[model samples]
Target chain A: MVAPVFDSGSFRDPDGHVFFYENEIYRTLTTDAVHRMERLLKLSFVKKSIIEGRIIDTKILEATKIFPKDFLVTEYVLWHEKIPYVTYPFEWTFSMLKDAAYLMLDLLSGLLENNFILKDGTAWNICFYNGKPCFYDILSIDTYVEGQPWEGFSQFLQEFLYPLMIQSYQGIDFQPLWRSTLAGIPAKLCYKSLSRSSLFKKGVFKYVYLQEKLSSNKTISEATLKHEFTHNAFSKKALTNLIKNLRLCLETLTVKSDQSVWKNYDSKNSYEEQDVKEKEKFVVEGLKALNPLSVMDLGCNTGRYSLIAADIAPVISCDLDPTCVDQIYLKKNSKILPVVLNLMTPTSSMGWHLNERKDIFTRVKSDSFMALALMHHLCISHNVPLSHFILLLRSIASKGIVEWVDKSDPMVQFLLRNRKDIFKEYTWENFQHLIREHFHIEKTLPLNNGVRQIMLLSEKKN
Target chain B: MNVLMYCLPLMATSTPCCAYLDAGSSSMLLQLLFGGVAGGLVFLKIYFRRLVSFFKAKK
Candidate 1:
């Protein structure tokens, strides 16, 4: 029997911590939180959310069936459905973040109708499962007070609204902002990016400008404000109105993207339709043979290959450009989770002790992977060595499908158009030699009149 | 339900545990003022006051 390992990432919650035992996810709820958990089990909306896969399915573990009985024996134990791949807000694209924000708002609104409300408004509470945002923090729900305004309102603004707002108004991607400040962006920080004229924007005056002025007041203390808030006759209608208004504002917000080079690589690549079909056939056959539980599509442009791999198993489709990831997310394809990832600078271990949020490497370890039409970009464009690129693939997955665009290819020539080709080892002979160092070459498929070669490989035994 | 429908006076109740997160005094106050048209009017007055002060301070 495997020992139960506590998830350091879930330590922030006072109610309980999540743990894994024998590959099963479990949550130990403190008695203080049990009432809410009990209520959630009976709620129609919560049941519907679980059925629709919006919320992770959970079940109360009986006292007799509890594993690691000595640990948290006093606390009420609950079993939770495990997410195949865990991702942070910083790894998400604009549409992914927007969808997560909406999921929280809509869930909170529905919970409020059932006399319960989500106490925490952090994006950390939601994770994408198969390209759709799903809330997993069951402990966040608490009894909705009759006249109390949403206590999570300010948190929602900082964590979701402000980050999203800056992206919409200034066209600045929120990934860098989220990476820098995990606690969500302050309204003042968001205010700085936006033009002075942007204050007149729909939610600007109310959510941003007004909130900034009010929060800047050092005269009133948060405790005193809470005291005053409790004294004031705030109504449920007012709270609902606020959520409704926020929904309207957030729904309209969108990031206007630039003409990214890699965003439309799949559609605009020089590869012919027949070559593409042959490549797809190779990837599918490779995936079928590997029979891996999960597949990671590195440089998954528009998730074309990810869609084909998704037919075989769950895929973690990744691309540097938010637009490409957003397109994959828009497809809402089952078994495919699209993440915005820059291969050169993948997300790092961060937060307190750097364990609170698992880095990209730790989170994205898969059984197999596909790096289709991506070699030229990584080695040729980004200056990453072909050996280093293959090493990265070998570290994350046991087997994968890698495509090599020859130096004579049009795209390769385009990448080398302005820069001098100092790369002596970017040849087929070196690729085979280097890749064999880490991975055993299983089969190779040629595409686009032999200009591109796709190889399926498995990790060589240690 | 429209605002014309009798706006019932609700007695504020305290739920200390509900606010483990520091919701910020001014932010909650602003949210209260952003309830509806009446709330918007109240915030508008505050906004204009701040705008006037901002210009005067700049000068």
Candidate 2:
């Protein structure tokens, strides 16, 4: 077995750090954390959660086998089931974050029934596995003390509740705000940004406005509240009611499904029925031949092709429009993950040493990808060179399909209307030459009276 | 600050401090208010629709 490498993103939690060894993910727990796990594991609720796949399945590792003698005796070792792909809150659609919030609240409510509580409510630990939200942090659960407040209350507000509120109430996308700061929308900032009229919105007055006012009012000494709560401890029933109230508040929130340019692209894209059939046929053939472990459909407008790829392998369908991506979840397809991702402005590696949170490029776990109708926008509109575009494709997947749109194509013409045509390298010959430099074109199919072509490609080893 | 302090009337009482996470004083204190019989019940009225939906799902 290879030496275990510590995961850079796992420094915040004191209980343990996650690491990778032998292609599997593992966690090293402090002895105290192991005791918490032991207590929780004995509960039928926790075991049932693992069986139902709401929590990531974990098992204590036998000390005699994997780790060296010294390391095993001191720190407890555990193996966690690895998720197929990891996506952050920034790339999530409104529905994705809402679903994650629901999962966290439900888990907390259920844990409290077993005399346990989640210590923290950070949004980072829940991941979408098979299009369902799954909580992965094992050490977050601990015995709930009587009269102690939900310790992660502010964190829940910052990470999940406040962000969703701003989006649903103000018609603003919270992704930009969340992407900028790890803590999510601050209560003060969120309250100030919200309109005074929104003070009447459901749960807004207390959860956001009141919470902000309360946090800033300084006179409410938290130390004093700590002492009082001990004397006037709340029953577990009351705490459960608080959780239910939060859950109910979140369920009422909604994001407007309007404001989408690509929401109806499948019908409005001007592709003839026969042309679409030809395109679908080409994608299916390529996927069948390669039979990749998974496929990522970049710029999957309304998930037309992602639905096709889902028939073959689990597909991560991504687009810049939340409305477009949200349609995938509405379809209720278990094989597809919908994410609101903008390729041109994908998030950079952030936090300490730029490794605490992984960059977009590294987290995409796909062996093959489909970039249908995406090249023209990246090259003509975004001004990325064809060489660099192909380079990105090769870096993302060993084999893939690229739909090359000619400069004369109507969509490309629309993108170039009344603008300086500085794309000298956008010609088919240049695209073919550039692609050939890095990849071997295995197959090609024409569409739309030869205005567009789909090429199956495999990266060439240097 | 004194004016606002008079209005809010801080502290239901003190509870033990929590773990590593910054449980922000206001958020922590609000829980005392929420855990009261009248408070969570009032909040539930705002989310009454959710209560309705929960029943619908059970059916």
Candidate 3:
């Protein structure tokens, strides 16, 4: 039987509360929702756009008896597989947001042709999958009727277009906007913040200003607010143009950040050319021996080592620095998933319904993991005990190949340059003992640098 | 497409005890696809089993 996967409290729609079932996701539609689905499925363009990859496709499946009493249920079609990693908007680079904006508009246009419209235009619905963008919420499409104003027009402006436009027109970063505001950067705030030059621009003036004006003036009646599930007037043409223009605007959106750190990291590492090559060789050989299909680089900085492992497996390169992750994304191909994650405070499962978002441990379980230059950060910066660190690493990957950087190492000294040395137990002997309890240490190779040592450990598979 | 979702559980390497509660990082898209197909099969199995039992009793 398909079990319940995720049920976000915020996603509790009166029409249908969606949930994942089995490997295929299904939405249990209420009796009223059945008509909406039937209407939406009737459009030929909808099918073509989705199948052609222009629009996010929502497939209708055969009926099932497992639905709630007041609901009619069917298993909706889903993507073949999940992407390697999920990067939140807060973590996204400027270019990534621009790409997402175009995707949302593309989907919206197709939905309009199908006589259906998106219920919401939140930026959170878009995810990068397989080098391209795909919509996460299939149920966002609803049956379109004549004369209704686009419900999510203002949201589309604020969440995606405005922030991107603001970044483009003004030099300010949108990161602060997201960190502070809950329901996207408000239109009034964006309007006020943007320069006077921004208002005169053809795309910005027509789309952002006019839409914001319409949204602010329009108000729902008290009766309609009481019955939230009731449908509104939907103009297919306006929706289509809105989507088309937004997409065109997003395609042209650009951001030139001041500096990217990882771009020049190859020249920055303390190791000599020979030492770097030796370290690379050791990591490549270890990965070849393990033959892992999935890998996680715990403290991957711009993915120099992660790329080596990526040759053998799908690698999720994690780092705390946005600049580093952004550079990796721009340089590397999309197959290598780069996520902005702090090893000390990694992405936790959070939301109104915690199940909506997966925690670091929940989302990734790699066949092999690499934590090179990672031990000192955990033991020194985060104050995580070596034993606890080993156990936490155990949960992330089946096997781990990590480096033990001695306190005397220049990198460790750099981290300790300012702070007091409270890491009394941070010794090679103590680390070996802690790791050996949970893993079988197969090999240890002392680096030519004389400051770092690499250890390969395999879990005792049941 | 619906059938494709059901095959993932069988395809996965290790079936963790926590698989049912939260199947790790399996995408909501994959989870929805796989979950729906798997759920549909179970629903049909019980649904048909009941039908067969009712018919046999009448016979």
The model with the greatest DockQ is 1
Whichever of 2 and 3 has more DockQ, that candidate is 2
lDDT of 3 by residue, B1-59 (tens): 55453433333233223223221112111212222343334333433565687799999
Q: Write the per-residue lDDT of candidate 2 for residues A77-179, one digit (tens) a residue.
A: 7789988788888788888888889999989999987778999888887988877888999888888887677888888888898889888988788888998
Report RMSD for candidate 1: 6.4
- How far in Å is the alpha carbon of A211 misplaced in model 2? 1.0
What does candidate 3's lDDT look like per residue over A41-142, in tens digits? 567865665575544556555444444343333443222234455566655656666677777777667676566778877777776665556676655677
Cα shift from native, residue A164, model 1 (Å): 2.0
Locate the minimum summed-lDDT window of 10 residues in model 3 chain A: A220-229
Docking class of 1: incorrect
TM per model? 0.88, 0.89, 0.72
Go through the candidates in order and give each one's C-alpha lDDT. 0.79, 0.80, 0.63
Per-residue lDDT over A341-414 for candidate 1, one digit per residue giving the tens place of the 0 to 100 score = 99888888888898888788888778888888789988998888888988888888878888888999998999
Give the lowest summed-lDDT range of ten residues in model 1 chain A.
A219-228
**What TM-score does structure 2 among the candidates reach?**
0.89
Among these predictions, the greatest TM-score belongs to 2
Each candidate: how many clashes?
A: 0, 10, 16
Q: Candidate order by DockQ, highest to lowest?
A: 1, 2, 3
Which docking category, incorrect, acceptable, medium or high, applies to candidate 3?
A: incorrect
